[model samples]
Target: MSLVVRPSPAIWVDGEPATALPIPDRGLDFGDGLFETLLVRQGQPVLLDYHLQRLQHGIEALAFPDCLPRARDHLASACKQLIGTPWAALRLTVTRGAGPRGYAPPERVVPRTIITSAPLQQDRDELSAPITLGWAEVAWSIQPRLAGIKHLNRLEQVLAANEARALGVDEVVMLDARGLVCSVSAANLFLVEDGRLLTPSLEYVGIAGTRRRLVIEQLAPALNIEVVQRDVHAAQLEQAAELFCCNAIRGLQPVSRLGEQHWQDHPVCSALHAGYREAVAC
Candidate 1:
């Protein structure tokens, strides 16, 4: 799909056009930045406040220049401009600004934050039917320093995607350095076994997705299931009754097949999807 970029609410440095991001941005140079992808439904951006809060937390954690309010205002205004679109994806990016060649951050840093809106894209088959997943031989490194944060250094995900493509599957299930299943290449994974829900612990790797958090927090109570975080292995899938992956952009998705294993219609997955649809409607 062709993307259309719009002017953001505020531009701190010289106030030109927010659409024109510089080439030498630290985010591009060394992946010294963070980003959040949010779904914009109708005119209102879904879970916008949460995305902003996470962006602020990441800025503080990474010691990026302070400009959260400006970024927030710009994003709010940009969302206002995208009203009446069928569906949209708002990608908000924050960089540590242009810096020297060395690793040391610029002493006086002016953070560059950009908010762009584009039409949301979805795979018809995956959304309608269960998706097929595969095991990724590429192992995720255990790095607590960057764990749970949506940092720009995404080589692991890229490699995992390549492996999944080679395996001829829709998504890839990744294992951490310790040989425990962490998550899918792009989304958080969940398993259903004996009416209980489980997901991988993000203490070491994987991004804690906003939609995944919402599901575990708001939907688990209704299902009367304890959403426990633990390590999973490829062998453990044999015991799981249902498997799925989730993200803010695509909502909850069911994994009908993973490698040689195949799953039929699962009640838990249906209920989860129903609950998510209700949540989105509300």
Candidate 2:
């Protein structure tokens, strides 16, 4: 995994026309940053407001900056450059900015915002059957203070994903230190049992994914389903009627296999996928 953004792809840093960063930047030094990956369709980003709001909340929570207005302008400018492309993936990263060579941050903070857009492959399959998932032996740590923040420190995910790949699984389910279902290596989890929606409460760990929030706040109500956010243990998922993973970039991933368990065409998954697409269209 190279950190280099390709020259072919459009990239901008802090409204500047460049692709490099300072070596001493806190983002590179300490993983002190936030990022949002958004899906751009036919030039326009879907649910742009939702994505921006999450990043804004994170920026404020991290006490980084009030850079949303300029960030939005930069994003708009980047999107405009790709307006004719069929599809693109946009990534926006904001770091606490460069600082002195110590743990103490600068008294005055200047955030560094990086925006990148790259054309998406035109022929990926989104309608394929549900993907296979496996349980990762590595457990995620419980950091309630950073829960749902989407911070840049993702070594845990990198290790988990590597293990899943080595095991020939498309994705891995991660458990928190307390043996509760946290999420997939890169996305949030949702389970359906007896026509109800269930997901782990991010109060303890895991990110509050953009798509996950939208599903709870909009799609679930539109589909007339009861949504529950509470502690989810690994044993609790054993008999689930349906399971799916979600994030902004990969909208929805229906789970077809987890160890010996299997399922197909779960009505709730289909309904929610339909509702989710429609909701994003608005």
Give candidate 1's error at residue 147 in angstroms.
Answer: 0.3
CA lDDT, candidate 2, residue 129: 59
Whole-model Cα lDDT of every candidate shown, in order: 0.79, 0.84
Per-residue lDDT tens digits for candidate 2, residues 78-197, read 888877777788998889889998867899988888988888764222433587889988889998778888889899999999989998999999998999999999989999988899
Residue 260 C-alpha lDDT in model 1: 78
Model 1, CA-based lDDT: 0.79
How well does each candidate superpose onto the true structure, as a TM-score? 0.89, 0.93
Q: Which window of ten consecutive residues has the lowest lDDT sum in model 2?
A: 120-129
Residue 29 CA displacement from its true place in model 1, Å: 0.6
